[model samples]
Target: MNGVVPHIVQYQGSKRNLAPQILQYMPRKFNRLIEPFAGMAAITIAVAKQNRAKKYIVNDLNEPLIRILNEAIETPDLLIDSYSKVWNEQFLYPEGSVAHFYKVREDFNKGNKCAANMLYLLARCVKGSVRYSSNGMFNQSPDKRRNGTSPKNVASNVSRISSFLKGHVEFMSKDYREVLQIAKPGDIIYMDPPYQGVCTKRDSRYFSGIVFSEFVEAIEKLNQKGIDYIISYDGSCGEKQYGTDLPEHLGLQKILLKAGFSSQSILLGKKELTYEALYISRNLQDSIHFQNTQLSIFDSL
Candidate 1:
């Protein structure tokens, strides 16, 4: 778990906390692991750390994030240099200093993956969120206390990842459905798409507000192909049906996972909200069957 720290630094919607549990359910053996919404690459990184999957294909529609990850994977030295320079200037600017933030963002947005990784650490929210404006720009304002902490050494982080990630990591910005083309049988796909039930303060729509029906259609395609995949979505409303009667009409099973807190309440506003992480799969019945049988055994015992 020590190696899990640096990997956690890069992700905005990281599943690091849930990784151990998720890993428990993963197949005992697999050829490759696919994460289409590789926000922080948390799950994939953990899988890589365990040497569970040889090849990893991680994709996201977020271009800057992808570029940042590529550099973190390919070149560490350059990223370290750039990040060091930025780390020195932390909190020197005023609050609401979008100008300074823009300069920082520009430097991070450069093609260097290492630099991008560093910027991701330096600029992300107090909680490592990458929520942006509706136009898809990084809108996370600067936090005053973001300083004082030891900035992560990109080189060291890269070295850790280099062992398992070099030449094996594939990064891209594309539609999540595109993952289907690259996946083959025996490939385990763990998708963490933008949750339909929640939105950041920025009011930004992630993943184009992925339509429930379209997502179902894509899952159906994966089902027909016998692809092994797990999808994570919103389920906070106690299995509240989504997008017309499709969930019941089409039989999309909802598995509720308590996501973090709501950003609304005054005093506890920043406190984590108990959201849900719904899991949908191609073989919905088999997945449900596994859940039911497991529950039955637990109940009987």
Candidate 2:
């Protein structure tokens, strides 16, 4: 909690800041941690840093993102070298960082979704958020705040990420349900699915959308199987709420966590902290609360 865990890259909607609070509800150990919407594998990275899970499954609908995470975790030196080469080339263009950023974005969209090129686009994109056009192209503009992350900094973090998750992770680029279907008793899943309504939009941040009814059905199935899971689906900032709460009959215990401030609030001319909804499976929630109570009692003794 004193310092941040090393993430492979900065991503929009990443739960990096909220990870500490989320971790509080997690058991001290689990056989596996599965993330079906693992953008940059944020929670998995955080959990790995704490050595909470023995095995990990990181899956996403975005192929390039999964590729980047795979490259970062499996071969840090190679990833570092490729990323450095790509980042340095931005300065080589006379038109400067903005021009170079667009060029990288172009290559990424042109089926050159190699980890390095795709990663550069994400690092340089506006607000570090991912946007795609209807036909599945990288559509975000450059964030002229400067060049993307420095190669030196990226290299350091990549190395640390590799060390954190090298042997324990299995990366997948597939429909999330496939990953969820394979889950067994010893697995605890952490999901951060794209927001409901916006996912279907062509230019929305998520590459793909799951129908609301479909998603709820999937959750119900997981519940029926007694799977331990936590979801970060809906949240609020200031007076604006993002999405509807999960249905109560699902038997989840909902907890609100003060995540980082919402950047959208800044656009609305108000600075407000965002509170994310964490819906935990009832069994896991009860177990966590009981363990916490016993710990408090022990501390007071």
Candidate 3:
């Protein structure tokens, strides 16, 4: 295994730790690996590195995330330059430097190749949390730490990944469900969508109930078409809290997984805690198939 690990931002329900486990349940071979709600894309990157699929499609509704991936994959040189600029101006900026931060965020939002540079800066900000304004602008305050990591000159590795993605990978910023029309049978789709939880006032504008419903619909369609897929989300509550009302309608099996990491939150004088990762699958047949494969492999040894 290549010991190259990219330091990426960890979102609330990131699947960085859950990928290995969930991957074991999917079809062993497929045409492409698709991630609609690719946040930090922990699973997407893991799957790509595993090199099991012929094609890779990583997408997200967040423009900044997409921009970062695009810059890393398509233009490593520009990404390096952008990171250098942020490092050079690191000390000149002040805490909550609205002007400087806004300019960086604006460039990213405007599809600047340098957007990836701003992502690192913003992630290192106040909470390791990305908070944006109502108009879709990053408003997070900067952290005092400077000379943040640049992942060395792994441009060759980045280029290798980009080379594999020239025409193999597709990036999109639309609602994931809408962009799922291209999914077909024998494809492995990994969806890491926003969990059913609260968002701070800063980044609250981006969440959508409608998008969630449509995502369920897309999963159902994929399942019906015999497309192989695995979905990971937050499962802090019991099985009943799997939002039974949602996936049950699709005849999916809600699998509670102790995935990723969790943190406590106290709000409104009440403490409600939950796990960071949760998953739901197609049905009994999929589970049986997975079990049979595992048993067969064990027996072979």
Go through the candidates in order and give each one's C-alpha lDDT. Answer: 0.61, 0.83, 0.58
What ordering of candidates by TM-score runs from best to worst? Answer: 2, 1, 3
lDDT for 22 in candidate 3 is: 65
The model with the greatest TM-score is: 2
Q: Please give the distance, in angstroms, between residue 13's alpha carbon in candidate 1 and its true position after superposition.
A: 2.4
Backbone clash tally (model 3): 2
State model 3's lDDT: 0.58
Task: Name the candidate, 2 or 3, with the larger TM-score value.
Answer: 2
Return the candidate ranking by lDDT, descending. 2, 1, 3
Error of 2 at 142 (Å): 1.1
Error of 3 at 85 (Å): 1.8
After superposing candidate 2 on the true structure, give the runs of residues whose Cα lies further than 4 Å from its correct spot. 199-203, 264-269, 290-301
TM-score of 3: 0.75
lDDT of 1 by residue, 29-71 (tens): 6789988888768788778888888889988876666766676
